[model samples]
Target chain A: MITEGRAWKFGDNIDTDVIIPARYLVTTDTKELGKHCMEGVDAGFSKKVRPGDMIVTGENFGCGSSREHAPMAIKGAGIACVVAESFARIFFRNALNMGLAIFEVPGISGGIQDGDRVSVKHDTGEIIDHTNGRRFFAAPLPPFMQEIIKAGGLMPHVLRKIRG
Target chain B: MGQTITEKILAAHAGRDVVVPGEIINVRIDIALANDITAPIAIELLEAANIPSVFDREKIVLVPDHYVPNKDSRSAEQVQIMRRFARKHDIRYFFELGEMGIEHALLPEQGLVLPGDVVIGADSHTCTYGALGAFATGVGSTDIAAAMITGETWFKVPESIKFTYKGKPQKWVTGKDLILYTIGDIGVAGARYKAMEFDGEAIEALPMADRMTMANMAIEAGAKSGIIAPDQVTVDYVSRRAKRAFELYVSDSDAAYVDSKSYDVSEIEPQVAFPYLPENTRPVSGAGTVPIDQVVIGSCTNGRIDDLRLAARVLKGQTIDRNVRLIVIPATPTVYRQAMAEGLLETFLAAGGIVSPPTCGPCLGGFMGVLGPGERAVATTNRNFVGRMGHPTSEVYLTNPAVAAASAVLGRIGSPEEL
Candidate 1:
């Protein structure tokens, strides 16, 4: 089963730099790191985020450097998942490897808004946005990836598989 | 049913007669790489695996470029670890700063990589080798660890796009402009999970440097890799550098491509990427006025000898605006020595630009060129996203070295046409 969240809208090509600035890369503590999420692009982002918020946006949503810190900071900041029109290749892998929830919703950007509570069923491509009680369709996660998410990131997933 | 250069190579490396798109296959690597910024962590992971030695010591090439000349102890310590690792494992090409340059530049220049081979590097720009008709990609440290231990890794074959070019470039337009134009048309994610193959008479006529500039920036378009089939230019370059002769690969005329685009370069002009992303681009003529505090000219992209020579030609006898501080770093020490011997250093210093050692500094906001809050600078480095070069609010305008040099002279974003 997949967890659901309220929507948090962002614009096109919301790069990794806007998600997490490089200054905070010195530490690996996710909690202390979440405080600075989106601080680079929007200083008010931290206070504005509520638990269970999901980010929705346009293409190349993580288009800059290959720093895994970008996804780590986002997942750490209580973002349930990021459903983008598309994602940069490195960011896509990094997000999955880190076990942060993300989906590719090719045509759903025009159908969503901020503060809209949405329940995403990853296996069925079902999306329930509570604001207008609308249902939107998206690509379902691949079975292999779903298993990885179930185990919570690549490391744990690898450990579980290897040990089993 | 046609095979791409990447597909053909991966199939050959995997010992298969043929491999198709979306099919997974395990292929042996011709080369595995890691630089200073990525090597230490990858080496740490490899050590944890408790392997006695790598699958083959000579197959690994360790180059220290990003933090070369060792600005701080932490970076210096990382270099020391890599050196010890290389020495202990008998790694053949462990290039130090003075002996090394950019890994991408050094790899081909030293003839360590060849066509139709599978190569992996811990750094993303490793895809730069795709220009030589190889199947190359970047992976994480753990993946590199696996490759080190087993000498092979699995990949799902990618579809490819064919980019056909026609027409001669106009005055003052360089390869950087053409690539920026291509990225603009494709946006940032147009080529995800696909390879891009450059073809036709136009791509054929381009110098090797131009082809490399195109392949180097292919990642900015979200492509897994971009390549041009090896032609006379490629063969000559490889032959001159490699002690042993190597074969080249080409895509079939009827090869399948998910998409294709064509360009005529006669209308091209100098290009610049605005304050945030590589895709945030505009022609220099369309790039309107913006003030700046700093200027930079070095990175894996646009940090070669040709880049410096282009800047030097524009700033030969001129002085930069008194307010702007310009920083110029050669891509490799060899490039530095060449620039010095050619007196490019004298021209740069005379024009008020400060020269730093070869490192990927300022490109990642790691060291040397950190931006102050609200201060904007025109740079020749890749990526202008917030905080990419330092403070988030400090804007960066990405341009070729020529435009960067001109902007440094004018104290704001301007064109090299004036110079």
Candidate 2:
């Protein structure tokens, strides 16, 4: 899988409350949550997003809450991909569990800027900053996780496993 | 090589005699939990997967404490989904409003979670059970759905870090202060993806309530779990409430650790975390004279009976300051009844404070005491993140119950020493 989009840069410790506040957690609908994505961090952030846009952030991104709504909100806000310096453990599992594309590349946040065109390759774990002509490699996904993504997320993988 | 307590518990659950850090392994789950906020999503995903039956109805625990008692029509509907699912499956540990508390506190209080158990909840504070020597952590809704169907999940073994506290604590320093100071030392992501094993004489002497408070905030330091090896205190706490036999897993003396830190508790003051981050801490004595609009003393973090007792001790006869709104929530029905019997409820009421029933209402800013724009509060609940208790412009100062109670009476961010 590959995705190319403009980047929205964020600082470290961009927690879940900033992703989608608790008040909006009343629903699980992706689109409903999408409208409020990053509402706390940068108000009207979702409105500025174009389809297939991506987010580039610093360390400990999505640092609080196990609410998958954080990832769901990002995905719903038309973020086709996310690349961060690091991720909180639960958020890393959550974004992938939902089939969202997220990569971790050390120092990528510093090189990238808002609206920088970026592209990512899932199989090769390659991340390219097209505007700056710089490249980085994310830590490769384990085979089982790669399989989960190939199946379009954990739910599909589990569905196939139980149904098969 | 000797194994850490986390390694031993994971190995037992994985059906192995030994396991090493960073190795991915599949393990059986002893308790699979979800609350109203996250359960609705898992329930929806379970329907999408077309799985007709759960792996074990008995092992699945559901609590609707996050936004229960029907916060609104939407939250009401969300909880109904979990309620109906619980009834359809006859899940044994389903807790409704009256019986429910904060899921983390409720599970341990009811003895549903035991030492050496593998517990997973679709809530970040699931790590709270590690206080009882369990290997527990938080997961996402989809993961909870998978566990619901498979009765199992996988984990990458995490490296262990050891923290030891020496000497005795000063007056007004409780588990909240200790954990706050630890977070201050380590920074938010200091223990990311690692197990924090809390030990030493101070820890052994700490009560179960304080122990839970310490473990509950491990997530604040980006740890996968926080644990204390079970001792006589644990045995006594569990034997009274736990109906099933439990296993106690302790770290071998020679266990490996990625890092270790020792602190002299006598030198540590009652710490308070400033707004925006739990890592931003300061000693209470120097916490500038900032007036507060609200003082909340309850949540999964410090809403236990002991916390209420301490707050009541500080607030026995003093009325809450006219400028402050004091909202106290008991964690569970049992705690509420106990407080009533002990007149803690009367004390709070007489002090001009309103006591809420067992609900996680204000902690996550869900309801009950949400801060208005530009308002500030001193809360005993965990996480003073921007907008954690209400408006994004609002600020929350995180402290222990005694400080919270005193601050309520003083109408500012002061400690019990002031009273």
Candidate 3:
């Protein structure tokens, strides 16, 4: 699978609170969550983000809270994927479980500027910086996770198992 | 190759002889826990998946702690889903308002989580159970949804880091301070994706509440779990409450570790983590007297009975500073009742502090005591991140219950010795 999009960069320690604050946690609806996405960090994130636009960020992309609302907000805002130097483990699991594309590319943040074009190949862990014409590698995804994401996240994966 | 306690627990659950770090394993969990905030989404996922029923109703536990007492209609609706789902599923452990406490505190108090158990929750601080020597960690709601059906989930076994705490703690120091000092030594992400195994003279000497406090903030250090090998203290604490049989897995002396550190507990003072991150810590004596608007002494991290008693000892016979509005919240109804029975609530009330019901309350800035713009608070709760306790411009200073109580008396971030 290939994801191509412009990059919206964030800095380090971008916590779940800023991605979507607790005050908004009363509702878990993705679209409603998207409408206020990153309002704590960037007041205009929801309005500015476009479908297929990737969020490229520095280390610890989703630190703090286990609220899946953070990633749901990003996916709901129509972002194609998130590429980071690293990710907080829970957020990494949450994104994949929800079928959101995420790439852990070491030093990927240094290569892509905000709004630069980027492409990611999920099959091979290859990331092509279309804007800068540079290519980088991401840590390979485990095959089991690949299966879950292929089935549109863990829900369908479980359904397949339970119904089997 | 010898395996750490975490590895051993995972290996036993996965039916493997031994497991190494960074390998993936799917283990059958003993306890699958969730709260109102995460469980609603999980229930929705299970309903969406059309999985007729859960794998083992007895293994699944639900608690409505966040926004519980249902702050508003929307929050009430979210909890209503858990209430209905539990009824339909015949879930054995559904803790409503009176029976509820913060999930982390409640589970331990009731002996629902025990040593050698593989526990997962949809909430981040699920790692708190690690203090009981359980292989526990936080997961996303979808994981909970799937685990509800299969009683299993996957993990990329984390490398282990051992921290050795030596020397006796200072008079005012507690588990919160030790964890804070450790977080300061290791930056927020320093131990990311690893198990923090704590031990040594000081840790072994601490009480179950303190051990739970240290393990609770393992998440703040970005650790997968914070654990202490169970001993007599752990055994004595659980024996009274735990009705189920349990195992106590200890780390092999030869177990390999990725990193290790030794701290002299006596050298560490009651610490305070300044605003924006729990890693930015300083000794309370050197905290420079930053005036505060409120003092909150509660939350899963420090809302246990021990924490309340420490705070009450400081607040007794002392009037609250006119400038500070102190809010004391016991983590669970049990702690609340214990504190009430012991007259700790009276001490707080006499000191001009208000006692709230056992809800997370303003710990997440969710009500009870939300800060106004530019207001600053001294809190015993974990995480002093931006807007954590209220308005964006408002600030939070994290410390133990003692320092929190003393700060309320001094009307600033100060030490108990100052009183």
> Highest lDDT among the candidates is held by which one?
2
TM-score of chain B of each: 0.96, 0.99, 0.99
Per-residue lDDT of B143 in model 3: 93
Instruction: List the candidate 2 regions with Cα displacement exceeding 4 Å.
Output: none
Could you report the Cα RMSD, in angstroms, for every candidate shown?
A: 3.1, 0.9, 1.1
For the candidates in turn, chain A alone yields TM-scores of 0.88, 0.95, 0.94
| Distance from true location, Cα of A154 in model 2, Å | 1.3
Over A96-146, each residue of candidate 2 has an lDDT whose tens digit, in order, gives: 899888888889878888888888887788988899998889988888788
Top of the candidates by TM-score? 2
Query: Judged by DockQ cut-offs, is candidate 1 incorrect, acceptable, medium or high?
Result: acceptable
For residues B1-419, could you state the per-residue lDDT of candidate 3 as single tens digits?
A: 78899999999999999998988998999999998889999999888767788989989999999887889999999999999999999999999889999889999999999999999999999999999999899999999999998999999999999999999999999999999999999988888999999999999999999999999999999999999999999999999999799999999989999999999999999999998999999998889969999999999899999999999999989988899999999999999999999999999999999999888879888888999999999999988877887787899999999999999999999888988
What are the iRMS values of all candidates? 2.9, 0.6, 0.7
Ranking by lDDT: 2, 3, 1
Q: Give residue B396's lDDT in candidate 2 (0 to 100).
A: 94
- Poorest 10 consecutive residues by lDDT, candidate 1 chain B: B138-147
Error of 1 at B235 (Å): 1.6
Clashing pairs in 3: none
The regions of model 3 sitting more than 4 angstroms off are none
What tens-digit string does per-residue lDDT give for candidate 1 at B373-401? 99998887667877878887788888878
TM-score value, chain A, candidate 2? 0.95
- Candidate number that wins on TM-score, 1 or 3: 3
